[model samples]
Target chain A: MRLPPILVYVLRRLAIGLVVLFGISAVAFSMAYLLPSDPVTSRYPDITNEQRAEMRRQMGLDQPLVVQYARYMESVFRGEFGRSFGTGNSVVQDLAQRIPATLELASFGIAFGVLVGIPLGLVAAVRRGKPTDHLVRVVNIAIQSVPAFWLGVVLIFLLYFQWRLVPSPIGRLSPMFISPPPVTGFLTIDALLAGKPDIAFAALRQLMLPALVLGLGVVSPLARITRSAMGESLGEDYVTFGRALGLRPRQVVLGDAFRGALVPIVTTLGFVVANVLAGAAIVETVFAWPGIGRYAVTAITTSDMAPVSTCILLIASSVAVTNLIVDLSYALIDPRIRHEYAR
Target chain B: MGEKLFEIQNLSIDTRRGGVTRRIVENMNLAVERGQIYGLVGESGSGKSISMMASVGLAAPGLLVRSGEVGFGGRRLPASDQKGLRGNLSHGVSLLFQNAKGALSPFLTTGRQVERVLAQRKVPKPARPKEITELFRLVGLNFADLGEKYPHQISGGQAQRVAMACAMASNPALLIADEPTTALDVTTERELLRFLTRICRERDMAIVLIAHNLSLVSEYCSGLSIMHAGQVVEEGALRSIFATPLHPYTKGLIAAVPDVDEPHELVPLEGSVWGGRNDIVRCRFSHRCPHVRARCEAGLPPAIARGGHQVHCVLYEGEAA
Candidate 1:
């Protein structure tokens, strides 16, 4: 039986992604293992040497490096990521509880970035050297230059403290409303599913500032990439031919130029999403959002090897998967790539 | 000859960069009679393409249409009024470009690209597929095999044919082909031009064939213009221009092309097309002309006309054809 070329390509990418994830896991394990502070010692500083030995043995940390790694891998395949010292709960459980919040925030951030960035880019490219183009470019630069945490704080101070225009930068929901049942882990979605509009609205309002901060960080790269790609596409012979053929200006620009510009824009968007998912730590901390970013930060500071390594693996996997998706999307957007893959 | 189908009169284009304005095309005039394959031949950057593009109101952003009037289908519109010209002449004018593959929307299938033009021409939705199939067949393409394929999936020759199909979708009265075969092979070039010539005659549509190769123009065009720097140095009936080449630049261009049966040393044109300064207002080809006289640099040489032929040269100022 022969596999289709697209299927083969996808399989190959998945295989590569798995190998990359494995490598990332090994690196994360090695770095954590080599840390100056011992996990057992740090967690139980006043324990006797004898007690520490027994604890290490119980945790399987007393084994050789290879044995410990093999055991950890075995447990990982069985969906066990050990326990978080700070929470005293299983790593998987902790992650399962917190992943939804991070995903919700990141989704909103990405949404904001794409919605604002792409149109701004299209306008700038169309208006090129005009005032609108200049304004968009300058604003993009300014947004990009500011740090995300600072932007988040500034927004909080202005929107929350100064004018009370938005909900306080407290958490994903107000004290008045309880979180809906965790059906799908996204508060907004779960609230909507439970037919609770007020809770969903509150969750969305709480998400605004942090998502905006995360989104502002994303906008510059997305807009700049989009602008340059769109500008180049607009200058292509097809655009001229389309216009000369008497196609409406809207049709020519959107249908011809925008389609040409999509490949790069999509690639950038994928990377931006992955970056936001992995590095929303500062934004999460500033907003007191209970997400993986804050979880990872705390885990890292506490030197809890299991949670820290898990977070690293999660970040690495997200990047690898995002890249794979982006690569696959190229074949959809461009016939050249599709033909190449078919061969 | 049929009636004049398209005419560009006194067309001048300027490019302003950092406060310095350079005249890229100056007082260009071209008239294409119905069913005529008119050649606008020049070296690269000699402003043939720019003049033709500006006439159709498709000039690039930096280019300014300083002065010109495009008369199409008996309706005259100023060249500077690009929106008006585009709106008015869109149905009557279509363009074919040098890079056919690049001129095609890569994302759209060949069939869809043609269909889009048909749709823009407001062909009813129900009749579009048949119209598209007919167009594909007209361009000698099999709709079943090549229609669904994107531009990159097809060969250069096939892509050019696809572009041709799209160009013909509008049933345009004039098709401006700007080096349409430059990117294709020699065989494809001849074949495409032959197809274009046949189409011109069959449909009674005028075509402005912009080319840099004099031999190609000589072979295909009924009438021709020889542009140097930014001005038309010589233009007339192709046979007459080839028979009695009056302008030195035209003679030089003809000499430059290699002939197989009549093998001769190719006399390469000495200087590039970039005329040093734009402010002088002299004959553009004065620096490159073999018989350059001091009077050549005095001012812009007037277009000396004799019979139907015209030449811009000091030597032709008093000569009778």
Candidate 2:
């Protein structure tokens, strides 16, 4: 009884996510192995066929595709991402070290997106027929259209080159600071917890440029969606009923109208997560923000098999996690969906 | 049924254009006594909903009252001051919309939706388990048998009954049931109407029953009005209006109702209720009137009264007669 409909829904989605992860792992493995370069020969030039064969036996590259896939899957199932062919370091360890910067940037980007976008949407909705809405419309369209890289370049040019207002772009911390203790593996929060407030601020400052570029794009569409949905919701009979119930303007907007408008708005955020994850590769390269994307880039350049496949599996899992979160949110946002999905 | 609830004096609604404002409902005067059901019957777009919604100061966003004075329970209501009438009055005066499915919040449980109106009154909250069970039972739901439920969990008739239960939550003095049975099936409609009429009698509450069916209005309402293009064309006691329809539109509407006493073919109305907003000076229904004449369009038609009944046709006037 404790495991009710929502729990069942979550379990079903997790199974589906696992299946998708397997598919991704297969594609990644095949692509990695199918590439022209061989790690044994490429890394060790003038290596004989006998030496390469021994290396192949140890790496299990001689095994059938299915057996190799099952073996890789078994290791990944046990939380072993295998060793990187390029660096000879465990892929899991590399990801653990790099993931903090990506999380900091991505989470901050989401925060700024919601903060800026929701207000613009409300403002546009309230001033619907006037020039204010029109201006907002134009701006929203413009913001979404502007590429993240271009925005990053423009902001970096204006902030760093012109005035030199921000900290150095070399790393997640300033020249003065040192690494904080790894707790949740997030540097900023870990810094704060370590009683290093200055280091936390420095980490935040480093993330600011990349966060702004990524966030501005996501925010524009959210604002547009909120405005349109609010306009529709405000006209519903129940909203009129809410008004008649003597609810104040603030109470009406927040309580009845906003919630009614939020269904579509929340759904849109799911797509945003997927887009941001994919777009992270570009943003990461631009800001030198180390994450899976930077790791994948290095793997691809040197044609590293095990690391690239493992990274692909991780990215696939993130996409699946994003979808699961979205599905869970639907039940919370509108119980009607939960009721239907329970069956 | 008790004492005076509201009085409408010279209520007029006009559709405003660039320079000229076209009159839709004109010189609509009526009164709703306390604990009484005042049925307002009309054809589609006859402005029954608009006139009543306006008379109670509840018009749609675009439609505005050009001139009117509404008195509720001895208190005068100015058109400009619409704020006071809501909630306190909304609690006192609940609106049962035409579409029950559309009225209740889809997200809320049927029981919570019912309890919501009660919550508005600043009353101490009732225990959820007891109140929801009782409310569901009152609305004729077998609360025990039904699996943990939401709005979509219930049937249509049950949903409407839930709507009624919600409306009754505030213990309202007046219920503006705007075609409350319009969306229900024949059997459900009859059952729901009977339930509503029963609630009105039991609670001693006033109801403004708006519908297109005159026979329905005649059955439930004590006193009633027939609307034509936003104007109150004819109004009096329900029995009197049925026995003797004074206005031409009222006569047409009565004639249009299929003879229930003896099964027969329906005599559809000769013409439609349209183009009234564009007319500068005329009885708007003149084009539709079988006995229409040049005199009907000469000016704004005068209302001729007899006892409690008022008819807005030129035939009763001295010169036209």
Candidate 3:
């Protein structure tokens, strides 16, 4: 039996995504190899040539560039990211241990941005020239221009130091609390599974300020895109037709207009997700949170080639996968494209 | 003719931009009885579509009904009462626009689109499918072949028929068709107009047909309103308006229409539409009127009654019936 067209399309995308990821990893590996500060020199500034050669050989650096890259690819295939020069732990294992905290932050940040951005955008578009629209526009522009690190610091100062409204911004958990058992590699979900409401609440409270800052960073672009998309959709003939059919104003705005506006909004959301992840890396540093972002930052600062390459490779693959999902959603969001895909 | 089903009296519409308001459609009086096709004819920006839209409470954004009273089913409709108008829409008022393909959602199939209207009309769950099929059939579409196709998949004319089917889903009493055939070829235009007239007859439905082409209006309309520069120039029974072209603007419009039997040089109207901000109280078409007089600019000409017809021109003020 013939498989469905959508399945075939998704499979083709997956194959392309893999090849792109492979290309990205290759570029990342080469870039990391070319860095002036390698593990040997950074670890021992006054090291002799004999000691340097031995360290290089152990890390497979003495081999040819192609051989090193092939070995790196082989190790990556075996779910190993080599080892961090400082800690001597598998980079993959280090990332796996810390990913839950980052995932927890970025997910909440993006969800907050979208959940709040869409409604604010709809209001702005629906009342295009009104005071509310002007206010939302000004606020969004402010958010868009403000850097993530500055916003995170400001939020921490205002909410923590000045207002004393929030708990200290140290890491994912409070000093009094212990982390919940891991399940599905998401801290919040793991906490809920571990059935420790107090621990979960504490983790969430610790996440709030950094996530809000990161989320605020993305909200502006999402809201701007949504506003324009909805404004255009609202001007469409079908929206007027819906109104003429005597459907309620709510129905016309939300049902007909929103559905038409969704394609562009979905496309924006995919990019927003990727941007939030990148923003989280900076946010994680500001808050001193133990996530892959800080882990990668430490590796880069110490000239650890393997961990840095692995981090770049991971980020690029995740972004590529997000874009694939976005491309697939276009078919689902619009029947015209879906029909074209079938053809 | 059936009793009057709807009327718009002294309708005035305006557009507000940057704290400035300007009148676009002024003192528009129109009446359409059940089963009658009332043609509102004018050039673009004459506010023909705006007037009809305001009548049905679907004015485009930024255009406001400054003053008007819409009467439907023997109840007076205040211009400000939009919620009441929306409520009355299901008491059967529907609209069809010129761009039929654009009027249907591209995201939904044609059949599903029709079903959306039916669902809005509150048709019972079990009966909606049957009703959708029946409506598609009524509008001359085969549900099996064309129903599942998106608006872009079908031909323009077919898409229009789908729009017509969606309009019929509500079984409306007053159908406001705004240049419904402007996008179609000559043959499709005629077929669609004929289909519209047939529906008007079969359902005893009153239709406000807003169009620019004089020939199409003359062919299909029983009653006609000729508009110029946002004001009514002449109006009455179509035969009487055609016979006695009193307004100079009306005469120029008729003269511009190409007549195969009496072929002559097509006289395009001399001047473009009046759009400047001046002479708030004067006749708008005075600049374009062939028989313009000093009195024409002093004030707008009042409608002069003559044998079941009315013409807004100073020349016709004292003419004998």
Candidate 4:
């Protein structure tokens, strides 16, 4: 039986994605191996040379590089990422616990970016030469220029200390409330599932500052892409033709031009999400949010190869998946692309 | 001539760049009677498109409509009030562009595009599909075959027809076709123009066929205004203007068309439309006119009328006197 062309296209993309994921894992493993500090020495600095050699042998690090890589890949295929010296827990367990926090933060950040950025961009494109366009451009540039961590610190100072508007920049939940049982792993969702609105709201409130800091970083690129794309779409002959047909200005701008602009905006959104996932390390550390980004950072500093490589593979896979979704979505938004793929 | 359907009087447009304002279109006037196919012939950058677009309140954002009045559907609206003109006049007018495919929304199927116009014209939802099919058939397209396809899925000729279907959906009284056939081959161009003329006669619709090719205008238009730079160098009924070519620029334009029966050396127009200075209030064609004289620089010459033909040139000034 023949598969449909779209299904074939998706399968091909998935196969390529798998190969890329494998390549990324290999690279991450090699790069970790090349690190100057040995994981054994870094963890137990006072150990004798013989003890170090024995530990390396036990960990399979004494084997040839290819053999070690083969063994690592085998364990990875079995869903085993070994143990993280930094946390004294299995790498998979550590990631499972912390991935939720990162995902929660990143999702909120992306939501903030899309909600605020797309409208601002459309406004800028519509009022291209006016003061509003200029103001949006200026504000986007300002937000993009400030470092995410520094912005997080400043926001914490203002909203937490000076104004007392939000709770302390501690972890995901206040000390008064224990975290809900992990259902989907998102604290807010898990809390709500566990029938605790107050805990869910507290989780959300704790999410705001870090998410905003990460989101502010995301806004500029999304808005700038949206502005240019929408601007180009607005200038298309269809817009003038639509106006000439007596379509309402709102219909012409939002219905026609915005839809035309969505392809690029969505493509940019994928890139933004991938970037946020990877770049959330600084903000996560600042906010004391237990996400994979902070975990990766901690692993890197302590020369814990297992968690570091796992985090790299996780981030790389997310980016690959995002790109795949973006490519697939192009077919959904544009019939031209769909036709091309169908053929 | 039949009753006037649309008119543009004293329409001028300016563009400001780097703190300098330059007039791109000057004191243009046009009148199209019902069921007439009028031609606005000019080279690129001669403001043929700008003037018509400005009259309909569709001019580019940077272009300033300095002064004008557009008399359309029996209402004389100030050309500067673009918002008012657009809102009031759009239902009575529709535009067809050179690149029909580009002028179509790529995301919408061809039928949906036409249906959108029908909806905007307040055709009830249940009736839109039939109306769309009727329009598609009217434009020489099969709705079932082509309606479901997007712009890129069809050929150039089909896209143009789809655009035509969209234009006809509003039942516009005046169709401003801005180089509608520029992107098509010769056979398709003739077919489209013939279809346009047939539609005009059948519906009593007026069409302003804007083109750079004088031959195309000569073949189809009843009356025409010849634009050079920003000004109309000549305006007259087509037969009379072609018979007794008065303006030097118009004569040159006619001479430049290669006749297949009697081959002659093509006398191509000498300077481009952009060679003139915007600061001088003289005949804009003076820089390119073969018959340019010192008197040509005095200012824009007054229109010297003969029968229904008008020529703005110093050569005609003496003859009129």
True contacts kept of each: 0.80, 0.25, 0.77, 0.80
Ranking by DockQ: 1, 3, 4, 2
Q: Which pairs clash inside model 2?
A: none
TM-score of 2: 0.87
Better of 3 and 4 by lDDT: 4
Question: Predicted candidate 3: what Cα RMSD to the true structure?
Answer: 2.1
| Candidate that beats the other on DockQ, 1 or 4, i.e. the better one | 1
Please, what are the lDDT tens digits per residue for candidate 4 over residues A1-343? 9999999999999999999999999999999999999899989999999999999999988999999999999999998998988888999889888988898899999999988999889899999989999999999988888988788888899999999999998878889899888889888999899999999999899998898888887788888988999999899998888888889889999988988999999988998888898779998899888888888998999999999899999999999989999999999888888999999
Q: Over the stretch B173-247, how does candidate 4's per-residue lDDT look in tens digits?
A: 999999999999999999999999888888888999999999999899999999988988889799989888888
lDDT of model 4 at position B317:
75
Interface RMSD of each: 1.2, 2.5, 1.2, 1.2
Question: Candidate 1, residues A1-343: lDDT per residue as tens digits?
Answer: 9999899999998998999899888889888898888888889999999999999999888889888888889989998998999999999999998888899999999989999999999999999999999999999989888988787888899999999999987878988899899888889999999999989989999998898899887888889998999999999999999998899999999888998899999999988988798659999999999999999999988889899999999988988888988998899888888889888
Best by DockQ: 1
Model 4 lDDT at residue B109? 92
Sliding window of 10 residues with minimal summed lDDT for model 4 chain A: A213-222
DockQ per candidate: 0.74, 0.34, 0.73, 0.70
Q: Residue A93 deviation, candidate 4, in Å?
A: 2.0
**Model 3 global lDDT (CA atoms, 0 to 1):** 0.86
lDDT score at residue B179, model 1, on the 0-100 scale = 95
Cα lDDT for residue B51, candidate 4: 95
Which runs of model 1 end up more than 4 angstroms from their true locations? Answer: B255-268, B318-321
